[model samples]
Structure formats: C-alpha cells, structure tokens
Target: MPLKLYKKRYEDIIHSDLIDRKKNLKLIQLMMDMESAFSIPMIKNEAWNERNKDVIQFFQQVSNSRRL
Candidate 1:
C-alpha cells in the first residue's frame, strides 16, 4: 500500500474503538516496530546489495574456493 494510505490506516487504528484498549495499544506498538524494522537504513542496505550483486558473488566465489 502507498505510504499515505498506510499512515491513514494507522491513524484509523489509533482512533478506532472496535478492539480493547490494551490490544489496540499492542497493535500500535507492533506497527511502530514494523515501521522501524523496515526503515531507511534497511532499505538502503538491500538496494546497495542488489546493485552490487556481481561484487558479492565474486567475494563468495573467492571464499568458497579458499574453503576447499
């Protein structure tokens, strides 16, 4: 989902009274954790690794050869 929509959903969850307050608080905390876990540094690392796949493969091959 788009970030804006996702944020809106989060806001809705924060305000909605459908669930017990404790569960709602837990859900919010989990969502916050999820957001942090997938934040900028993690994404940048993934993108960097993707862009450097050939370099990574080269290092892996060298390491495997040394292990033989």
Candidate 2:
C-alpha cells in the first residue's frame, strides 16, 4: 500500500533530520529486496535497530514531491 500525507506537515520533515545516511539507504535497499524478491524477513526483527532521521526526511521529501 502507498503512504498517506496531509498538508504543510513540516513535523514530517523535522522527523527526518540528517542522520544515518548509509544505514537508511540500506533500509531502502532491503525494502526493495523484500518487494521485488520477497525473501526479506519481517519489518521488525531481532537486531533491527534501524533508526535514522535522514531516512525519515528523505522519505518525507519523496512523499511530499508526490503530493505536489
């Protein structure tokens, strides 16, 4: 399913501050693999400490662009 967004929600942007550039990219790759390959495990795993503000921000930016 696609994501949903509201208007002028900069809180979405702020949640996505500059952090975890590389690991976030990795997360994206993992998601893609799960979508395309379907071999990925659950979103929450045993060692899933994936937290990054930049990843959040980048996703918000992409979603915001789509909204526009």
lDDT leader: 1
C-alpha lDDT (0 to 100) for residue 9 of candidate 2: 36
Against the true structure, candidate 1 reaches a TM-score of 0.32
Q: Report the C-alpha lDDT of model 1 over 1-68, residue by residue, as the tens digit.
A: 34445445555655666556554564555455544543423343667557766444433332332211
TM-scores for all candidates?
Answer: 0.32, 0.28
Tally clashing residue pairs in candidate 2.
Answer: 1
C-alpha lDDT values of all predictions? 0.46, 0.39
Q: List candidate 1 segments past 4 Å from native.
A: 19-68
Q: After superposition, how far is residue 9 of candidate 2 from its true place, in Å?
A: 32
Give the winner by TM-score. 1
Tens digits of per-residue lDDT for model 2, 1-68: 22232212333433555355643554454345434442223453433224433334444454344321
For residue 13, give model 2's deviation from the true position in Å: 23
